[model samples]
Target: MSLSPMTSVVVAASLAIASGAADAADYRNNPFTLTYDGAITQNLPGRVNIHPVTYKLNGLDISANVYTPPNYDPKKTYAAIVIAHPNGGVKEQTAGLYAQRLAEQGYITLAADAAYQGASGGLPRYVDKPSNRVEDIHGMADYISSYAGVDKARLGLLGICGGGGYSLKAAQTDKRFKAVATLSMFNSGRVRRNGFMDSQLSSVQARLQQASEARAQEAAGGKVLYANDVVLTDEQIAKLPFEMYRQGFEYYGKTHMHPNASAKYTLSSLLDLMSFDATNQIELINQPLLMIAGSKADSLYMSEDAFSKATGTKDKELFKIDGATHIETYWLPKYVNTAVAKLTQFYARTL
Candidate 1:
């Protein structure tokens, strides 16, 4: 395995133990147990709390959480946004946080667990194909556009981290979304093929061979191989490189982990991920666009590249959160608040 990915395994294992090992199911009921300061723990006095829901997507059952606005009246129309979770995330993590916050702003929001991952129903679980992930975003929009009290014409979309990349790809063809926004977008294709910052360029052919072999094994009725599932010590995790990987382990693998989210994907997924590029046709997004990233985030390049290539949208802007890294923007209040404020304004104006 590449050092960039192997080191991340060390970080996840170490932090999972450090965050107080327990039954993963026990963490779901109270998602805010390790949430950032001021995180809403229950339904706001007048707002609707998360409504655990299930919908059909491509013949599979997809689980999701819908947060309705305060004093929500089904008879009155309201804007809606479909929020997609990060690659290793679920509806109960950062995606849920942003969904709830957007609901508070009077927009009905839906965050769903992608098909084949999290609580969704799919065979050979944890497949991470770009086509499937992008379809998941389109499915979210389809489900939310017809939801009670939603104004289909004013629908919007928000994607974080890996989801941000998928969201861009989805919005490229799904023009139903009036506005599109992404936070700390991480191009899964670029990194999966070239390695983080292209560090694994030399090993591309070798890794592709590995992935092909894995796919063949699965096709032969063999057990599925997984990636990003490793065990390590706290001391080891602390010494790993990359703040995003380090702190990300703490967020998803540790404090905020959910039972349905294991942070691992089928090793064979590398085949599709390596071949897909979210920015390949980004100019198709003619709707208003807002891409936000932390100034210090190493993943900022993906967002910048996507923003520069988005020639179809004249009303596009790139905002940066000063001094914040990618993972820090996931839960840290200072940066989360800034992102939410900008998103609120952007959606209000465009959607």
Candidate 2:
């Protein structure tokens, strides 16, 4: 059984599980490489400034961008938010947009590339295991909390797409995040193990066998195996069954394409992703929680399941953006405005 087809759509949908600014100026002028609308062209005074930063996480260098609010003064205390990008997504896309937007609202925000993906340093690249993803969220919290002007006690978190799943896991016990929220929350493990909507349930055991073989090969110094590495044409994308994947490709492939964002992962990663479930121990996340998703999103079930099981947080709320889809929440300005307004209110009241 080839590992390709099993995860081709699985990872692509996970890509659905999931910014910027520079033009004309040299890369250094806007090293952040944000791609969202109204991105910071230059760090003018009294305006949000993007800071490109790198930090060590578990012996690997992690790349991140920190956005400071207008007229930011390190001497004064401020609430900070840690934004986690979606699976196969880098910090420079929607994550950066949210970071910049949150910063404009007088909050400092940090968005980082996952350790083995994006611009972050890691070997045997594109390894997308559940543990590593959860750790990335924790690492972001660690780095952002120590930043100047960040009031550690007032920290909040916003995770997008697959990042939302990992964020739920991270916030399960990392109470440092006083408030937690997710937009277009995607359960990467659920979709990866069951194949988007459970359409591949019959092939679960077969795929597991292939993943085991891939792991054995990797351990024996054989060539590394990968999946979902194909680039799709316009006709191919339109043929995709789910609106999430159809629009996701357009967002990540063309309209908001970035070199660091990819839809592939190490095939052996299935060994770890299969047994994982984002909702496991979700009751442990006692922090105030807010989950937002498009009312029409094909991935809405994932958010609904996780939200219903979060009984530990009496303060939790599930918000749906009317007329929006999973990928639509990522870039549509109208949907983004509604989501941001709700987030701003939630964080302000909780943090």
Candidate 3:
């Protein structure tokens, strides 16, 4: 494939699973085979149009999926929302679920593949560079603003997991987004620096050392290795760090898995996430912000901490779902509905 300079090539290669791979053979040839079960699926009365488009960002061609509301009219502008998927996720992941739901609510939504991951463009696939990730959100905003039915003045962002943190970072610099929201937001840098729940702070230096070695190996023409906390086997799932990690596999590895989804990521990218900090500029985000997380989730603390640091006083709200876990918010009906309602209300009010 001849890639445009504006698109990062890394994303195209990483997000695509090899043909005949055991993990996603069914989805490779049939992208639409994955059926989504949600309120949007049941309630949407008009034809839901899914568009495959590309935009230039950071000198790379970034791919995206745009969902237009039923009865959409090019002459009439409507509120727009940009959705960013979780780490190692594509636009077809849970993001599409959220985008389709939001679109059914009369909003035009764009779900984009993050640079270096999914269908976006980047080098050394699955390399999660914080700066590039933030830029990718801005790129989506740029693309959405130009669409015929989109109201650029009323732009909002919805990011899941790592995408949430990047959304925060993007909103800090790009005032174009009038409202912002994040679900199960993961502070990639914090998790990398201190480990989950700050349990591995003592080993941070050692991890950095190993990452340095990995970088050296890559520079020496060695293939980079990818590491994911989730393990697929029954025995590995039994030893997972948290029940949520095992559950995440069920969502990302099997039932909801897309052919483009990958459990692997470039080892060198860990170095970037280890030092990246999105909360540092939370105060700069003057727009209305809604941060959602499960009260019992191990990742909830990061969202809480971010809400505390955010300077947008009256415009910011945090909702902690009582009995839910991190992965539960991804597709669980009860939690996903609550999140969608909150997000719709937040954007409707602020955007």
Candidate 4:
């Protein structure tokens, strides 16, 4: 639970439950379990079905989950949305929760893992390049737009945490997305360059030096060195600096644990992340935009800053969930419901 920004493989930790999700004993050793609360337990009678899928993105296999509504009819076209997981997350966690919920609301949804992370195929696992992550979003849009029962012209986009930030960038030019929404968006570049809350401004040069050396080592065929690569004890987890990072451990490392989910990215990734900004040309997103974040979230500034730069969208809004922290908006029942409610309304009206 180090808030070092490396553990940014974050998610809404799944809708924070189905009946058996409240009891850990039911799934303690179940490898097939989705690991997140309210996970699909045998595809309920009237619920959506999650179809695990894979497609090529920049010559790599990208893993994804496609959610289709109950009694889905392929003959009839339907609106769709692409849900992007946080930087350190996969399709089965928060991204899946939102996709399933949206599908329940009559929209086909696709959630995919960025290449090199989760179950996706890529070299040097966890590279986390900005261009690659953005390409993942475009790839999702490409696949989902052509999916059965989906209307190519009525597609929407949603990203949670780090994915949120990337979605803004993608929607800027990918006019296929008629509407764009983000929940707890995390600005990967801003945090990487300026540090958490800009607390490490003075040490930026030193960190860059470290990253450069790490790249040199990699070039020399040395073992990969990762940032925030530490195993924490229970007490140590309890002592983490931010609630977002602390609760992230409880979600990804314990309750919502999945074999493919991880927070570690290559140290070389900083070179690209530090230079990329999701809002660099945000004004290009002329589509309807909605940015949601917990009012009490420490990462609220990222959402606010991005929202402010989106002047191109006349139909834009910044909504905050009062009293909820950054991570709470991920899985807390009330918070998740609030976010899903807003998203449903936004997509319904726009798409």
Top-TM-score candidate index = 2
Q: What TM-scores do the predictions have? A: 0.92, 0.94, 0.87, 0.91
Per-residue lDDT tens digits for candidate 3, residues 1-351, read 221211111221112223222343234444443324532322244656677788888788788888898988889999999998887677776788899889988899999887777767778887777888888898899899999988899998998988898899999879899898999998878866776667566667777776788789999999785655223455644555665566666666665667567756666776887898879878999888899999888778889999999975468899988788887888788988988888878887887
lDDT of 2 by residue, 1-351 (tens): 133445444444544222322332222334466767777877989999989999999999999999999999999999999998988788888898899999989999999999999999998999999999999999998999899999999999999999999999999989999999999999988887787777678778888888899999999999998877776566766777788988887777666767788888888998999899989999999999999999999999999999999999899999999999998898889999999999999998998
Which wins on lDDT, candidate 2 or candidate 4? 2
Clashes of 1: 0
Whichever of 1 and 4 has more lDDT, that candidate is 1
Per-residue lDDT of 173 in model 4: 90
Against the true structure, candidate 3 reaches a TM-score of 0.87
Each model's Cα RMSD: 3.2, 3.3, 6.8, 4.1
Q: Give the lDDT of residue 56 in candidate 2.
A: 98
lDDT: which is higher, 1 or 2? 2
Specify the poorest-scoring 10-residue window by lDDT in model 1: 9-18
Order by TM-score, highest first:
2, 1, 4, 3
Give one digit per residue, the lDDT tens place, for model 1 in 32-105.
Answer: 43233344567665765667789999899999988898898889999999998887787777888898889989
Per-candidate count of clashing residue pairs (backbone under 3 Å): 0, 8, 10, 3
Off by over 4 Å in 2: 1-11, 14-31
Model 4 agreement with the true structure over 41-93: per-residue lDDT tens digits: 66655679888888998899998888899888889999999999986777777
How many Å off is the CA of 92 in candidate 4? 1.0
